[model samples]
Target: MADPLLVVPVREGTATVSLRLFRTATGDRTAVAFSSPLALARVLGPGQRWIRLSAPALRHMVADLGVTGIVLDPAGTLPPRSPATGHDVHRLRVA
Candidate 1:
């Protein structure tokens, strides 16, 4: 059977958007995916932007980047709240 597509979280950079990888408690690099949008939202929140990719595709895309694992339907763990409340800026620098 063909690999099924999964919901993968992504983030935007200064000039391009890319997959958002994760680190385990022990500092292992991993790519997180979800079986469905609902599952993704449950962990990453409703406003998370994502794209569809099969597990195999994700593995290939991240292989060169040192990502060694894929986490499906990861447990939701909200980051500790920061006293500061604002969005971080992302801008491209010109040489």
Candidate 2:
């Protein structure tokens, strides 16, 4: 709570960034944040963009949207990928 958390922002139609919200298994809206930038990249991948925000500020911002839960430092939803590894390299052909 003391340290500012790394937050992922989403721009829907407009350039203004808004806190990215997630859906719980039970259909509830929750906000997600990471304790540090490294933690964020570990979960959302290195190229993922983010913003810094305090816990209180994050909660307040989400509360307006009826999101009452915050998930902090959650584990990666998927494995992290890096271009340096070239594991994601692929080829495409024109039709």
Candidate 3:
């Protein structure tokens, strides 16, 4: 099976973050930074392989996307607050 695509919310302008997933006209999966949950709902109806990302992994993924100045809550459910930086490539393992 193909590896599941990872979607990280890079920018959260409000108390709740919006999620969006889309396939371009040319058939390429694309996600916009700071998108809306309504848009995500429109795309993801059922049987999608979506998963919540750990804090560390989420930081790494966003950095990979060239985002900066991210602040995660210290008391968040995800552990290991240290952000991973200066890596050319990152790999996420899902079980």
Candidate 4:
């Protein structure tokens, strides 16, 4: 399995922080900084104060913040795939 994807963004003055959980075009989930692609582009596409990090790095950053397990896999949450398509796709969790 590959590592979870992550993005980190920091806002000015007010100390705004946003973390987005994303599943790649593939079926794995990653915690990114922006909630959506447009959001990320807004922050990163422009000159913003932020740094991208991997899942492990993110876990380390919040290790001391009393965060427990953050699961990303959608094994039992969604409906099973059809044998006809045979594609391994994980559904995104829409809020």
Candidate 5:
């Protein structure tokens, strides 16, 4: 059988990162989870941005996927808020 391909950032037209759970005794793939880096980190860390993974998931990912690295993407979809604009504000100023 062919090995599964791994990718980061998960480009729009490409496959997303996948986590394959494995059984310790036989080293077989038992389950798979897929998501964007942001989504995965959100799940792993919950409401907190920086947190350590529980021993179990970390072990499973390492054993099953042979993963040794993770890279954070810098792009974010949400735009920053802009300053309020209106001519009425200037007119409302007191002399």
Candidate 6:
């Protein structure tokens, strides 16, 4: 089985960030949890408009999928605020 995909619905305010473990081939979606802005920020990173999920969260998500690696797609979504001057990707390790 392929590694599950983590779908993050990013929006403004204290919106719900759904963490779904989906399998492409089977079209299966497992609702891992619904994370809040503050909670997500604790795991990912700070977002200008939307909340971010930390590296540990990413690692944990991938680990739960029984895979060593998984893709992190922001779903072409961003916060309502204008883009800020900073690095797009944050480097993180799973240990």
Q: Which candidate should be chosen as best, given TM-score against the real structure?
A: 1
Cα lDDT tens digits for candidate 1, 58-86: 99998998876787887754442222642
Candidate 5 lDDT over residue span 1-64, tens digit each: 5433322211121454333222222332232222343553433323212223433454455564
In model 4, the number of clashes is 2
Worst 10 residues of 5 by lDDT: 86-95
The RMSD of every model to the true structure, in order and in angstroms, is 8.9, 10.7, 15.3, 13.4, 20.1, 12.4
Question: In model 6, where is the ten-residue run with the lowest total lDDT?
Answer: 86-95
In order, candidate lDDTs are 0.72, 0.60, 0.32, 0.46, 0.29, 0.38
Q: Backbone clashes in each candidate structure, one number apiece?
A: 0, 0, 0, 2, 0, 4
For model 5, the superposed segments whose C-alpha errors exceed 4 Å read: 1-29, 46-95
Per-residue lDDT tens digits for candidate 6, residues 1-95, read 54443334243335544343333233333222124554434444465234345545666655665543444432223223223642222333221
RMSD of 1: 8.9
Q: Model 6, residue 34: displacement in angstroms?
A: 16
lDDT of 4 at 16: 50
lDDT by residue (6-60, candidate 3, tens digit) is 3333323247443322233343333322133333333332322234454455455
- The reply for model 3, stretches above 4 Å from the true place, is 1-43, 67-95
Estimate the overall C-alpha local distance difference test score of candidate 4: 0.46
TM-score of each: 0.77, 0.65, 0.24, 0.34, 0.19, 0.26
**Deviating ranges (above 4 Å) for candidate 6:** 1-7, 10-18, 25-51, 74-95
lDDT of 4 by residue, 1-95 (tens): 87646446434335655443334444455443443444545433544345566667777765664444344322222334344763323344433
Question: What is the alpha-carbon lDDT of model 6 when measured against the actual structure?
Answer: 0.38
Error of 3 at 92 (Å): 24
- lDDT by residue for model 2 over 4-93, one digit each (tens)? 555654323256655556655565677777777787777667776678887778877877787757777766354333446524211111
